[model samples]
Target chain A: MEFQSCFDIIGPIMVGPSSSHTAGVVSIGKFIYELLGDYPQETNIVFYDSFAETYQGHGTDKALLGGLLGMNTDDSQIKYALEKAKECGMQYQFEFENICEYMDHPNTTIVTAKRDDHVVTVGGVSLGGGLSKIFMIDDEMVSIRLSAGDDFSILAKPYQRKEKVLVKAI
Target chain B: MMEIQSMKELIEACEREKKSISEMMLMVEAKKSGRDEDTIIRMMEERLIKMKEAVDSGIKDASTAPSGISGGDAVKMSEYVRQGKSLSGDYISNAMSFSLATSENNARMGVIVATPTAGAAGILPGVLFSLHKNDGTPYKELVKGLFTASMLGLVIANRSFISGAAGGCQAEVGSATAMAAGTIVELKGGTPQQVVNATAIAMKSLLGLVCDPVGGLVEVPCIKRNVIGTSIAFSAADMSLAGVESRIPCDEVIEAMYKVGKDMPRTLRETALGGLAMTETGKEVKERLFCRKS
Candidate 1:
């Protein structure tokens, strides 16, 4: 089952509007932040299907940006993430698509980010109730479940890209 | 040690252990998370505190949401309910106002706990607080009621779905309402069988509901639907407590909901492409909002 805990149903106190669109999306973005060891200086985010249709209303853009900046789900600063991104000199762009070529979920996003000399593309899906799954890293398919209370740094360890190995695989 | 996968299994486990639904849930959670019972209870209490904070703040605030489409209704409802002329009595009237308060706060990007999903977050807290206000159900009892709600929600979520994007509003609001109904029954000293029956009754009422948020926002109908869902939960709980049984079993109803959601069109499933989202005024609202943003 995708849902395992009581917290999965009744908890994850968060800045809302939506769980699938905002809270869960934040966890996916935070997963990327942990993967990179910090916030990336640049990001290109593509939202698919339902997320594309309602991103503006649900503040999905702000949620992802807030997570990329290492904000938690309940962080009040999430509402001002767009302005904060601009002030921090983080360059970001958003694209909308009818379908994601990589993931098969309605609430899916693919983010390609660049930090220093490193660039990575990640695909994630928000699976409702502040739960998420990272389905792709670079060109490799992987499965990593992200819950709100997870220690993302430790979760990111096994998937952390080895520069030389990644280059060879690509 | 037995895995409670269906409503039948859940009821059976509760009987076998001579435990209430909430106690069974605590046992299961303690085993799955490897956390102590005290820690789990503390965590749930934290969420309950957050839910109460959202309701308290929203009841007093009259400001509109960022979209300017929803707000101030909670204050209006709270004021009206205070007059004590409500037709639905204290339990349901208080619940409506509380539901409105929580949903309005959610639309404003305020902090709230998701009961299964954020789109349907208002219903449980709405009913729980109303119960507390009407009968003096202690906060600790309400916290246990939350566990009862979570147990029912977990079954529906795994057996069917709980996100609107995945299964339409039937899966979102419908699931939350079902959980609330079961929670109410359990808190009122109903049997586990009665709790599952109440859940079934509530879910059956909203079976074919669609997710059609106008302007692609969770305002407009979403907030109001949460308000009405409270009454449905109360009615279902009362019915089940009176020994009424669902014509169809709870697990079968959940399976049916899953099938219906799978057959639902993409346009009706939170894409804002159909239903009320496609009405004339809906288009106008969408245009106005986007035009202003751009």
Candidate 2:
């Protein structure tokens, strides 16, 4: 089942306008933050389909940025994430698309982030009711469910890139 | 325990165990997660508190949302209900005001529990708190009601969908209303079969509703729809409790919802290209918002 827990249906208390658009997107961004071990200094985000169309009203942009800055789903500071990102000197740009070549879901995003000299690309989809899935990491397709109470840092460990591979790629 | 994947299986489990739907859900959740019942109960209690906080805050706040399309209506509804002039009586009117409060809170980006989803977040809280207000149902009982709601929602989510972008408003608000109907029945001591029938009836009522949020904001039709869903939940619950039966089973209703959503045009499935989203006023709202952003 896509939705496994009672919390998947009733919990994930979050700043709202939407659960799938805002709260689920936050989990995906936080997964990327955990993968990088820190907030990336530079990033490019691509929103697909419904996310692309309604990101503004739903605050999907702020939700993703807040999570990338290590904020949780319920963080009130999400409302001011754009200003916070600017103050932190985090360079970011957004692109929109009608369809994602990599994922079939409407609420999908691909984030490419760089911290120091380490760079990573992540593909994620918000699967409604505050559930999310990390579908791709560094061009490799992987399946990781980012549920509400999951320890993202612990989950990201197995997917962490080796220092040797990073050095060679750089 | 075999996993309860369908309404039939769920009813059978409840009968075989001789437990209420909420009790069955709690047991299944405990077994599946390997967590102690106390811990699970505590977690659900926390969510209940958050939902209450959202309703409490939204009821008094008269400020508008960022889009300026919604807000203050919750305050108006609360005030109207206070005057005791409502035609729908205490249960439904109170539920309507509470639903408005929660959805208004959602539109303002306030913290709220997504009872299935944020778009339909208002319906459960609306009905639960109304029960608390009118019938003196304790907070502890309301927490059990949440489990009942989640159990029904889980089946709908698995068998069909629960996100507007994935299916339509029928999946989002429709599922939440169905869950609310079943929750009400369970809270009111209805049988497991009656609870599922209430769920089926509620789902069938909202089967073909579209997700066409004006300006792509969760205001306008969304908040109002959530308010109306509470009444439907109550109606369905009352019908089931009075020994009424749904013509179609709960599982089949869910299947039909899924099929209809799949056949729906992408434009009506939250793309804002059709339905009320394409109205002149709706187009004006979109232009106004985007123009300000640019």
Candidate 3:
């Protein structure tokens, strides 16, 4: 089951107006951060369906940005995540869509993040109760469920791709 | 090694192991997470503390949220309750005030535990805290009540959905109320079957409820619905404890909720394009907030 712990339903201890829009999105961003091994230098976040529709009221944007900045779901900084991102010089942009062909869920986002010369694209859906699942990673359709309080970094390691490096004889 | 897909399975597991629903959940969690029981209990205790903190801060702080649509209702409710003139008795009225407090805190994006989901966060805390206040239930027992609530929520979530975007208010508040009902029953020494019955009865009461938030925020109807959910939870739990059985089973009720949500119009979901979001007043609120921001 995607939800394995009692805490999965009862806790996540997050700053939130909505768990699916806020806390779940944070876990998705956190998974991207884990896959990249750090916060991205520049990121393009595409919000689909419900996420695009009510992001402002629910603070979905702030939550996602907070996660991309390497903050956990419960971090109070999520309220000021935009300013924090600007301070950190973490370049980010948002794109909205009526639907995501990559996924059927309304609360979905495809985040393309770059750290140094390495880049990874992850598509995730917030499945409510602060549970999220990554449905796409770099064009590969993969299902990785992220429960709050679990170690997403370790959970995302297998999906991490080694960037190809070229060395010329000096 | 029992696989729990439905309330029936959960009840069967409880009977087979001679354990309470919370005990069953603790065992399953211990096995699934490979963590010691003490560690898991400590984690739940931490969540309980956060929930208490939110209620404590909210009942006294009447400041408006960023949207200015919701705030101070919790404080108002607490004042009304303090005057000793409530019709729903101290337990239900106190729960309502606490639910309002917790939900108001959630609307402000203050720290709180999502009892299944943040929009429905207030109900569990409202009920649990009221139990503690009125009946002198200890913190340790309250933690076990959380485990009981989670076991029921896990089944509902796995069977259906808990997000308004996926389902509707029925799924969010409804699932939380169901969890709360079961929790109340478990805490009151009800049987596993009674807990499931209470859950079913509570969920059935809100089967087709929609999630039409005004201005797309969790304030407004969201907070009030959470407050009402606690009363429903208490009523459902009382019925279950008194030997009332749901005509429809808990699993079937959850399945029906899932199917109804699938058939729900997108406007009734979290999308701001329809339902209360499109109301004249709702549009005005959105316009005011938008203008202020821009």
Model 3, residue pairs in steric clash: none
Worst 10 residues of 3 chain B by lDDT: B1-10
RMSD, one per candidate, in order: 1.4, 1.1, 1.8
DockQ, all models: 0.88, 0.89, 0.84
Candidate 2 structure quality by residue, lDDT tens digits, B1-294:
547789999999899999998998899899989999999999999999999999999999999998889989989988988998899999999999999999999999999999899999999999999999999999999999999999999899999999999899999999999999999999999999999999999999999899999999988699999999999999999999999999999999999999999998899888787899999999999999999988
Q: Rate the local accuracy (lDDT) of all candidates.
A: 0.93, 0.93, 0.91
List the candidates' TM-scores in order: 0.98, 0.98, 0.97
Q: What tens digits encode model 1's per-residue C-alpha lDDT throughout B107-217?
A: 999999999888899999999999999999999999999999999999998889999999999999999999999999999999999999999999999998999999889
Q: Which stretches of candidate 1 lie over 4 Å from their true place?
A: A161-170
Give the C-alpha miss distance for residue B50 in model 1, angstroms.
0.4
Clashes of 2: 0
Clashing pairs in 2: none
B84 in model 2: Cα distance from truth in Å?
1.2
**After superposing candidate 2, which stretches have Cα over 4 Å from the reference?**
A161-165, A168-170
lDDT of 3 by residue, A20-53 (tens): 9999999999888888888888999999989998
Clashing pairs in 1: none
